[model samples]
Target: MRVSGGSTGGTPSGGDGRDRSDPQAFKRGRKVGQTVRGRLLAPGPQGLFWVNLAGHKLLAALDHEPSLGRELVFRIERLEPELLLRDITPPPSAVDDPALLLAALADARSRFEAVLHRGPPLFAETGAAGPNAPLAPLAARKRLFDWLASTPEAAGLYGRLRELLRLARAFLPVQAGRPVYLPWAFPGLDASEGLVTRSGRTFTLRLFGRLAEAGRVSGIFSLSMNRASYRLSLERPEAGEGLVAALTSVRLGHRELAPVCVHLGPLAPAESGGLFAPLIAGAARPFTGLRLRV
Candidate 1:
């Protein structure tokens, strides 16, 4: 006889005097005394420690004071509403140093600016189509991660990134069951392309020149890669224009991220062909639309 409900607290079953340890047979059951990483969130209504681990939000009752927003390893014990956590332990090194996190965020902002200031807008001044587009940038960013690993700069914060590597690698690997999340805060990147660089506060207009077409002007073009997502767009200052037909493609490091033509709205022949060369040259498969375990 197959028992849908077990003898006791919904234990793993069909408990009819037989072992039902078949994982594929039923829903997953957590084994007692398993170690897992946990990130502590803000306090609850009762000031209870709220933790997130392996995409599970759990409550942790610790033997010692806890640091908020920091990840710690915890042992799991079964509980009804949520899992019970014990033996909570901190990571070996400090990973939440504010200064270093800020530096990393700042550096990323600068790289965006560098691309904006690489030169006049790619398509603004040239009609160099049919095979005359600038190549991809040599490097998108200085190896901030590599530098942190090798040097003592941002020692405390660097350690955090290192600690996350075990988890972080899961996100970008060619294939994996679980997806990874970036630790740093993402800044707002608006359509204006306005950025305040450390060297000096300045505004950059990528357009070298703009031509008026039938009471409308368009010259803004941008290619952006966020994590593993690649996006290319051509804008006309005014709306309701016809689509421009042309052939375009992007290749990154031997991978054809985008081997297709871009269609835009009524853009100059010269401008449309030349504008996206940099992005295509640097295009590679991005890390978006990943299915998370959650």
Candidate 2:
């Protein structure tokens, strides 16, 4: 049974089962564990304990299915905390006033609706498409699970989730599954070009300029990748304060903080040739620091 999206909740079957007890399996699993550990250690700020939960669940998923490494497929899902709270016990602090919490959630939802419709203010200037662009609005819903591993914010959120899973491993008999790393938070970047300094905060944007010159893309969306941390930050100039505020207010689920795949769907295959030069040059550029703090 080919389960979609790396849902590591099952046993390996058929010929794959022969390798379950192999020492190599344990080694691979250990590597995955280490990745989760590193993610938690590098969440960037203190006072932010909530970010490790997603990593914990990913590690847990890997423990359950060692076969994940063999498969080319990966899946990631993001869940709003309130949508999840009903399914799991809330932390003590959150347990006292479910009604108040719900009310806050409603207000947040209203605010989000207002802002999202207005579109991100900063991004507004850029005129980039939203999570539901190119494709029909309904089609975007199916791709929600794709956003988890794409952006630094989502990554930070995932790091917090993984930490939670590590904590629970001590008491819960949770199985470690295969590692399925997805890049949901990153949107539209299959690759890039230009120059970046190692661990620096700013990198030059070149490839997109070329693409724009050629009229391949509608316009350029600048992307910067930080080598040391593997963080990808996109310039969403249209994103307004409201979206930023929502980002600040957002909470991640311990099991899934960010969707790994934020599928904007495909561009015309013919247009892909137009992106190649930029993609190659961008990826080849040296690492530099990122300035995503806007």
Best by TM-score: 1
Model 2 agreement with the true structure over 143-210: per-residue lDDT tens digits: 43233233333333344333322222232222222111121222332222222122244322222211
Candidate 2 off by > 4 Å:
1-69, 73-75, 79-195, 199-205, 210-294
Ten-residue region with minimum lDDT total, candidate 1: 182-191
Local error of candidate 2 at residue 143 (angstroms)? 19
Assess candidate 1 and give its lDDT.
Answer: 0.32
Q: Each model's C-alpha lDDT?
A: 0.32, 0.25
Cα-based TM-score, every candidate:
0.22, 0.20
- Report clashes for each candidate as comma-separated counts: 3, 61
Query: What TM-score quantifies how close candidate 1 is to the native fold?
Result: 0.22
For candidate 1, write residues 161-250 as lDDT tens digits.
333433323223232212111211011111121111121222111322222222222222233331112112333534222212121322
Q: What's the CA error at residue 169 for candidate 1, in Å?
A: 14
